[model samples]
Target chain A: MNDISTWDVVRNLLDGVLWTLGLSLTAFVLGGLTGLALLFARIASTAWLRKLAKAYIEVFQGTPLLMQLFIIFFGSSLIGLELSPWLAAALGLTLFTSAYLGEIWRGCVESVPKGQWEASASLALSHFEQMRYVILPQALKIAIAPTVGFSVQVVKGTAVTSIIGFVELTKTGSMLANATYQPFLVFGLVALGYFALCYPLSVFSRRLERSAHGTRAH
Target chain B: MTYAFDFASLLEYRDILLAGTLRTLALTAIGTFFGLALGVLGAASRAWQLAPWNRVFAVYVELIRNTPFLVQLFFIFFGLPSLGVSINEWQASILAMVINLGAYSTEIIRAGIEATPRGQIEAAESLAMTRRQIFLRVVLAPALRKVWPAICSQVVIVMLGSSVCSQIAAEELTFAANFIQSRNFRAFETYFVVTGMYFLLALAIRQLMLRAGDRLIGGRRT
Candidate 1:
């Protein structure tokens, strides 16, 4: 818990970045898949299913991620299930991202002009086929930019997992800082790691936005 | 595994939970009020492209937007004291919340400002309106009306994000719940009640914001 070499701290910090990356990527992919389903359900369904999906979005989006993580991690274990910290954090982030991403994609889907739907309907395709072949393809192309943009949110969100004791980058940074008595050096590098992971996605999202502008404006 | 349900314990902590909700609501209201003012100025600066200040505002917006609210909270609560301007946890948390919300609001409102039709500005000028008159009458008012929904949602986000202040021991709802659980060891019941409270409060605030925003721009709806 005393003074430690910069190298030791850096290595430990690197492990933190790995956990952050692991948590963010796991959440992003799983969240994306789940969100796509949610978006489809929201758009292509009866009134009840749409309301259910809306409720899901509102519940997840309305609540704080930290509280959600706490509920998943500790609350479940309180009942009968013994959930791991990583599992709980991942589940929380996945649910959070799904709500946001579902809404984003739903907007994009609905943003596809009604003319497109009418045009597709004239071709005698079912609603699902219209989405699969025509609407979704265009919507997904538009969705790529915002989806990549939200990955920044996903990356930043992994920092919250530290609160749940998942020992991700932020948690590790705090521990190493506490052990080394170097909060500034430790957190500065921690911020650097997050910035490094997220800045690229930010740049990518902007590029997607530019490309989107070049083609179709959303 | 079957466990008996206990609602009485949760009900007993209603006063504590109520206090936390009030604190959180106060934080959200004060934060949104000042944050909206800061946001308006920031958006105006960007719209005006006020030299170096605009560049500085841009960096502030992007930096805050790209990072985690938790890190920002830590930086303020823990990172600021090293520079010798010590603020308490509550003040620091509120400062950070306002700063973060200000940046996001600037972006949203700037988009609104930019969307104002160019011909209206020409019309205002033809009527001999000065720059100030034109901005208030022709620019800021209508722009905010149109952008109210986006701003409203981001404000709700600020409300939700304020829960992160609990980490710094801000005595907000979540912080209060954490205290109750640690003391009472009723983690599940405590959080269940707390979560329900948060959901209800958030829904209430969101509705209020929507109604307020709609009224502010109710004329525009027609």
Candidate 2:
């Protein structure tokens, strides 16, 4: 029965933006760590590790993120995990991000010349030492741009968490739209919030790509 | 872990699941067709730098790409109605999918277009071919051929993204899963089955697109 002003709407949505950023950051960091492990498994000498890692990546990549979130959120309670929306959202996004980052980084790692691996092997370096010093250092250069670019996706992905009642930006926008009867303004600002967050990353990613290509050419 | 998993209970609601799968496929079919067409036009405008339209599409592509599709869908489904433009859930879902895929494919196709060798265009000009003919014969096919795999991936992404349409009550596969679980109190089983269905759908769509890309573009060049 009470009226909410435009300022109040903006403020509420801004609060939601913080949650979105927090979720994105959490997912990116956790996902990056998990993806690093997955990458090692994928390229490991043992066949079973490689096969298992491949399966994990394929399952996550193949299913829709929304369904992943739903399964984690709703399915967990049935098995007695009692996951809160926050925990489910974070866990779901972490898995999704890890799958993608693992694949992307695997491509980057594989792109490193075969000579480097052989040279390290000839130098009597172990597999871990070779990856730590030669292969990963070389792969890191190519990986930076894409990894940053993926952060934008991670940010946009937080919107889907709203479906599981995480109260992030998109969810806040919807609630405000209902309360204020101003879906256009509310959603537009919500979108603008994302654009503000993502456009810079996209531009930076492109710039890095250009620079990477430029260096490779020389 | 006292919960008994009963997948057989879902067998009774197979019709709902079947209908939902059909609807999702229909959405992806229409979305992919129109989205790629719009992408071609947008890519052309930007690749050639066609004055005002180029600038228009540049902004359009960035806006759509940077924002989440769910917000875009909410804007169309929920926001537009407030501005006196009414559309149903199905229309909003399709429109959002098309617009989302269009923006992405525009970027993908433009990368292909920009990679066209300058000498090829000059050679076409020397043959007295019109600009239109040069773009069509000399540029478009090869550009498309080069980027067809990326386009296929993006299309599958758009298809997977369609699962979110259930938020607006579009009655897609996810919606069916939700409906079934709510009815039978089998949330885990329903989602587990539906997620597997989505995985199979993604694989099928990717395979279909690859084969189509081969027939449509790849075969011509060789």
Candidate 3:
């Protein structure tokens, strides 16, 4: 067997990084939209809708992301839909992301003072209008930091998709480790690749959090 | 959809599932115990600014927090052998879970520690308390109480994340699901049942942690 050079491993892992980034971005955007809808259902006037949303969030949050991917990937095939690993990974991560994001944003929404809700109601605004025009606007500001913070989780989460056979960084690292017989170097680079992706978001999230608190202090 | 669900097939493998469940629980218990202990030590070191150790822990926390747990598991299980530090899959899983939870709980506990009032520490100092005495007797309990809910949530998250331990063939609950499905060719039913099992486990752990927190820290608050 020909020996794989270190440069070749690094170059190949960089290719995996793009797929990881693509998957992360796809999950985040799709998840954010779905999470927004779930957030609305969660805080809606109807008790049943709120409970339904709560149950959805609880199930997704309670179960492992790997299991979710397995169910979607394998379950879909059993039910006659042959989903590609890409589709399965995206769908699973999207659902997982939505549940957590919905819950996070829900906390932010509830943190908006009760007075804002009452004032909007006193103005004869409909529930939807109150949320769309007043409550969500305020919640959006507070939600920014946590939402950005969660994006870091989304990036880290993409690594799990590799288990479903998506050739992302982690999967690529494993393959290269096997070929090169250099597990330490391959996996170390894999961890560093993720750190490069996630650390900036973490720092940015902290900065946003601090500035948020700074404004609140005044 | 032409497929008929067959959860009954999984029942025949009940022993496998049971063993797997116990293994998963055992891993989580061990991980949580040592992880939280490590968190306490790291948090104290960082919170008190204990020189070199503080910097060491800061880098450790950042490294663990930023990377995915799967990669860490891979490094410990697959990577370490090359460095002449071999560990079995079970040991590697436990180690990964402990380290992952340790980094997170450090940050979580540190937040709690940092929130301790300046006057409280000063009062403890005036009472002629040593540094360790002040940290343990006066500062630790309330800080833990404040952060107990967050800690509980992180514990549950780590528990759920433990499902990935199956990747390295740790023979946990998810591993049982994989084995059952591969045998019966009932992937959907197997995974579905196991997911339900995980949901129940998560709920049970959350409730248990809540009660544990109340007993450990709640009474002291009054």
Candidate 4:
């Protein structure tokens, strides 16, 4: 039997960082597109679409991500569908991210001055044409800083998927800690790995926020 | 085979659920009270241009903000014991939550402090107010008022995030659900009910925090 050394534990933990990044990327991409859909639904002319989108956002935002992962992973199995941890984590995070991003983007859209809408309407632009041509471009500019800011959240959120047996950074950290019997060292390294990924994003978000504010101040 | 949903079976665990909910509320209350207090102090030090403490707190906020709360919890709950500083799940949960909330609120409150008109502070100084007096009486309340809504939402986020405390067996709502599901093997039913409870709890906490904000800092001019 081979015993795991400190170096081996660190090496395996580094591997886990890759999965964390991969899952985060997957969730962000899928969640971003879905979230854009949700934003439109939230502000749609149809009253029911807005209501339905509101409820969807509330349910996802209100519950803990851990429970959402659990239900999605376990509940699917009860219905005779074999759901992988990867798929479940992706789906759970995508849904959760969609709700938050939807709300954030909706705020950006609504914050656009009323005159823009009125002017676009007077131009006889259809609702779709107005959103596509006039409103979304402006909203997208307002949304950029926040959307990037939210990506930090999406990165940290991937850690929760470890609980559902996904072999992300946190999960591997725990495993290496158990094998090496050095919880402090192993988890410390894992925290560093996460910090390395998230800190730059945090700094970038702040810069984007400053730039956004700078433009607005002018 | 059909899996019939039996929510009635969950009624038997109502006591456990209620106890867990109360524990969660207690943890949230304790964490928020101390966290906000500490955050104001941290923000004041930064606002006052205290050199090393300001630098110290800046690093602290960045470190806490960048890391995942679960890893933070594990480090405190699991890692600390190895160094001979032992604490129970409840203590660890509270400590982690408070520390996490403190870091977040520091940044939020500091933003408010930065927004304070410089003239206001100068006027207070011209009135012969001491630094501490000016900070506490003149700055803190208004800083809190400016950021009250943001802080309230963050508090609710912390409350919702507290469900992760169950990972350390802190006996919060999530823990209750796990305990019941293990016994009855009704994982779906258990999580479903608990999720609903959490949704309701999040709503209730938001309402409660907003009311507390209004009462505490609603009316007075800065």
Q: Mind giving the per-residue lDDT tens digits that candidate 3 earns over A84-149?
A: 999999999999999999999999999999999999999999999999999999999999999999
* Interface DockQ per candidate: 0.65, 0.89, 0.91, 0.81
lDDT of 4 by residue, A144-211 (tens): 88888888899889998988899999999988877777788887888899999999998888898898
Q: DockQ for model 1? A: 0.65
Clashing residue pairs, backbone N/CA/C < 3 A, model 3: none
Give the per-residue lDDT of model 2 (tens digit) for B34-129. 999999999999999999989999999999999999999999999999989999999999999999999999999999999999999999999999
Candidate 1 residue-wise lDDT, A1-218, digit = tens? 47689999999889888989999989999998999889977975599889999999988887888888888887787578888899998999999999999999999998889999999999999988998899999888889999999999999988888888899988888787678766667777887788788888988999999988997555
lDDT value, residue B157 of candidate 4: 84
TM-score of chain B of 3: 0.96
In the range A54-173, model 2's lDDT, one tens digit per residue, is: 999999988899999999998888877889889999999999999999999999999999999999999999999999999999999999999999999999999999999999999999
B72-120: candidate 4 lDDT, tens digit per residue: 9988888898888989999999999999999999999998899889999
The superposed Cα distance between candidate 4 and the true structure at residue A122, in angstroms, equals 1.7
Chain A TM-score, prediction 3: 0.98
Clashes counted in candidate 3 amount to: 0
TM-score of every candidate relative to the true structure: 0.94, 0.98, 0.98, 0.97
Candidates' lDDT values, in order?
0.86, 0.94, 0.94, 0.90
